[model samples]
Target chain A: MSSPFSSLHVVDLSGSIAGNYCSRLFLDFGAQVTLAEPENGASVRHVPPFDKDRRSLAFHHLNTGKRVVDLPKSKAELADLVAGADVAIVPQGFKDEIAKLAGDRCVCVEVSAFGADGPYAGWQANEMVHQALSGMMSNNGEPGREPLYGVGNRASYAGGVAAYITAMVGLFTREDDGQGQKASVDVAETAAAMCFPYVLQYFYNGTNRRRGDQDIPAGQVLCEGTWVCIWIYPHRFAAMCKALGLSQLIDDPRFAQVADRVKNWAEMFDIIQDHVRDEDAEDVVSRLQEAQVISACAYRPSELLENPHLAARQYWDGPDAQGLPRLGAPFRLSRMPRSRVNEVTE
Target chain B: MLPFENIRVVELTTAWAGPMAGRILAHFGADVTHIESPTRTNTWRTNKGAPSPVNYPDFDPGERRWDRVFLFNSQNVNKRSLAIDLKAEGGVETVRDLVLQSDVLICNFRPGMLRRLALDYESLSKHKPEIIVAEMPAFGLEGPHSSYAALGPTMEMAAGMSAAIAYHDGKPTVTGPSYLDPIGGFNAAAAIATALYHRRKTGLGQHIEVSQVEAAMQFIGPEILHAAVEGKDTKPDGNRVAHAAPHNAFPAQGEDEWVVIAAQTDAQWQALCAEMGQAELAGDPRFADVGSRKANEDALERIIADWTGAFDKHELAAKLQSAGVIAAPVNTPHDLAHSDYLRARGFYAEITHPVAGTHPHPGLPFHLERAPGDYRRSAPAFGADNAHLLGEVLGFDSERIDAMVRSRTIADAPNKEA
Candidate 1:
């Protein structure tokens, strides 16, 4: 069966991670995506996590399935590229020109840091700045320490996902009246959306939720030198006790009820930790799973490549043109198969 | 008309991921109806037979507290609710009829629950060939761990995100909030929209499955590639990226207040030095280039932190940004709730519910010029739309509805004893 977007055409001109990721989604579903890069190449090409040859892994990951072309210097040539596409992912600065060129029938998604006309529109910012301002970093680390940010390009990736959704929505709407429109996706706002229940908690009350040590019925425990995360709610307390050989604590008054467990979480956790400390991480996880308790070992990056579950699902896509492994399609469609990544010679 | 004005969605989902997909669709003007089971209530509504204090308004779990929990209310906005026991007599037939007329159905149950309930994609497609079904499982449907249970944190760990995002001490840590849930939610929405667009053209519908772990692994694709090409594991470097230096959060004047600064370019780094009244530092050999600054990062961080510690976080952020440096204050929840920027942009909608009261809720992240999304109403109360849906949409008579209610197939309140 043909891919869902097999006939769709997309032009990606932003050359940033956010723009590339949005276009990558289209490419994965068999869209014809052309990436226009500057003479110096896209900015992601210069970013880190380089291979042994100093080639950027970030660039290869983001630009694997798309066609690369030198950005046209002439306005007419650029306009021709946009005019031929059903969708154009443009930077904030180029939205007006691109939207006008694609005129009325193509969706133009303007991806930016703070958005086109906001107070911080012209301000210089990166992924870290976006995370900080979006209330995500504040609740990440221990309260007295410096706030933590995610490891990779989190904010940009989120903005890209939002932009992809925006493009799809615009196209779906255009089907009704055959008129396209311009959409704006702000990285800062997208980052804020990721910080969900905490943001809602503040609106519910007047308190700023702080990050601290783990509490009872949830959190990480050291099992044979590996930190395994386990999540348990009130409903699972009894089953967890029986599974972990803590059945003696099931009737303990201090831990009998949810409120009591919350009040005495520290003591309860210490006892739970003692029971699982000497067990192997995998064994502990298996035991927890057997009883319907959610648990997983915090795996290193290399470990995921060898993970049995992902391997069984055939979730890795490459050793492609660059001879490096990549993540497979984000979602599966029963009617269409995922397209393989091919070499795109510059 | 709004973007999704004519679309109708049936959401049989619990917890953050699935409901979030329905929430986004509802926000964009889809008529989304949530199917709830009184016997097995959504975990977000009650943590331990009662509402968690941190989830309810003002730490108060008043009467009908299920309707007031922020955890459920935040994600269920602009959607209607109906309580139906799928295990009851004629329940599966009622839902099958609804699906035959609706455009989509979304669920996040483990792999086989829908199959057991006779509501899986294969079962439903037999009735409505053009109905879209989106399922989000922690793992894929046929994987070895497909039937294994998972929550947000475990999903993150299984996906290799927690291992990559570690502190300076190199201990793996999960993000305070369950980050995978929202990411999975966004992916599900994107998939459904794509399928919808396809159906509009071909008159065909398909089953879409979003593996939550795989969706999250895409975010760290570069790290996975690094691990593959180099034949080595990538260790977590706290708050630092390989591309930039002086890229850490520093303390501000107030207690627990901090600001993040990232001088991504040489010009930005020089400008930051100038703003700190230490132009000589830009010329210093040890801090002259990205590589050199990274080599002497500890010293450079101390020098920058000393300069930033004297100013307020927000003021310092603005001052630095004005000087061409990328900077932003670490905003706590209180700061976010009272943010002037968010208010000016209309990112927060003042939503009022009869039970939960009026509050500022976060709105859509993106905007479409011609078809903007709106927050039409607050979240629904339990079974708030039973009469309207059963009578108007499903064409069930009042007597039949009453008989179903009497048989406990439908309920207006939660059933504590199943």
Candidate 2:
């Protein structure tokens, strides 16, 4: 059966990862987000992870619960749609035109790469470009090298979050005045600016913050070809060590104090890696959890789904008829909020 | 601007997350009273030590005013800061009274801690029926690992991004970006807004509980789905494009500068190749198809990079754009602050700070043509509107205000991190 979100009278005029990403949130929540195509479809149509049919993976991921309207909705039609919409989520550039078209009927929220007004507003950007621009890349990755780019568009995701929230605020504000209002969200590099606190310390704490190296894994041990990281951060290290048959290490001088161990992490890691490299990830993961350590089994995307924790949560709603898997909402209520739209009759 | 101009929002939060929700309201012209602890300076002041997140090493070799460059000022524009420690005597009731007259309550402490402080949903609902109470937790309010310790890195790793964000040839990396925190901040704001919409329809406020894990996990949807189905191995590809060829950042003319160029159709590639006077290369069998081009990316990258290396990034960007190729320079903070295009579009706005001088700061991301005016307030002083909050919201008398100040329960002044 088709999902509910495809039924709403929605219009999505977003490009790259940011605006499209944000609109997808509402789509998954049951908003009928129609990919409002102008001359060409969304820009990410060119981006990869494209389907077997050669459709952009970026497009597939974000537009899963939405429909694509090949023709652009006319201004009058756009206004008519918004007149009845509970919320209108638009990216920043189209805000002025959308608000003018919709007048006061729709609650308008716009998303942009940087802030609405500033010297850098019109700079061209996508995912990696914005990451560096946002000051996030500076704090990520390793030392003595170019800052590594994050997989998936972090800045874009941040912008999506910004857009989703801004629309909601407009939704609420519409209540007091009994009229819909306009709210523009500064997304892109501007929104991603606040994504790191430690990065801010580089500016604040007089410390130079750069990406760390592949050689020195933060708190992990180098073993063979892989880096074996121990599950003993400052907060819950003692408990994790107990399950590893290494409880004595909690009191051992080499690993005695959290501060000391942090200071001499490289050497300490060598000792730890020697012990745990041969141990299975499942065994190590289970033992650490049994000892009450807040630990996780770090794996690639494929292994993550098999994780015991996610399975217990039943996080997926199961793959739809299209053969793509689906995830649940990020926020949950006991009553459970229904997806705003229902299955399309067509 | 100031979309909620007349609406009053009461914020019971500290540090980052909850205050962010309040900031969003304030930015759009909501009258937000930030409830703080009288005795403790805003914990966010620690970042007060820097210039901006983009500026790497703030070494004041000489004493020149750098600026109050931190996250707090940007997140806290146009809001009222009022101090009232809930841990102190009568602090809980003081907040309760404010809630009665307010539209929303935002707090980002640990799950049960808010309840322990007597500032939970049940208590606030008593004061106002339609009062929306938003609770921001590091983890969810329930679950086995509910009461866990966390920060940005922890959350980034927890959400399956740490392993997913590795370099193509190297180990997994952590960007140190608070992967889901601000998203959590944004989600809290959105949830509060949606609930308020429901409340408007039904006249009932809601209890919004947002978890950082869920926020982080939201981004990991493809992976989660993949695991849910075929259970495949999805690792880092660095900057590689799985389905497209010649999609990588090529070095541009400045220190550590680069430009990303990607194209799919043969026409776009023909256009790019023609622009570079390398149309002959596009017809080569090795790069004939998108798949073949992606497969031979290293060789293709060399050809593209060599061409890009000669032209100035902007000129190359313009040339590539004219050719229907997707391209943009990897902008640094300096480039962002000073770009002419940003200035022309009026995307950045300048706000005079209490201490810092007029430095061009970023502003609202979206603009409405119907009412394109100013959003109210600038980055305010800590508890700058203490009197307004206490007297107006709680109906505190002059004597009571002075008594609270004397008792160190409230303060109109900041600790002066400057």
- Weakest 10 consecutive residues of candidate 2 chain A by summed lDDT: A208-217
Model 2, residue A144: displacement in angstroms?
A: 3.7
* Candidate 1 wrongly placed segments (more than 4 Å): A213-216, A222-226, A234-238, A241-280, B47-54
Model 2 chain B: lowest-lDDT 10 consecutive positions: B56-65
Q: DockQ: which candidate is best?
A: 1
* Candidate 1 C-alpha lDDT tens digits along B206-297: 89999998998888888888888777776677897667898999999987899999987789899999999999999999998999999999
Best by TM-score: 1
- State residue B108's C-alpha deviation in candidate 1, in Å: 0.9
Which candidate's lDDT is highest?
1
lDDT of 2 by residue, B29-90 (tens): 67888776545555554323433334322333122222243555666767777766666676
Residue A257, candidate 2: C-alpha displacement in angstroms: 8.5
Task: State interface RMSD in Å for all models.
Answer: 1.5, 4.6
Which pairs, if any, clash in model 1? Answer: none
Error of 1 at A243 (Å): 3.8
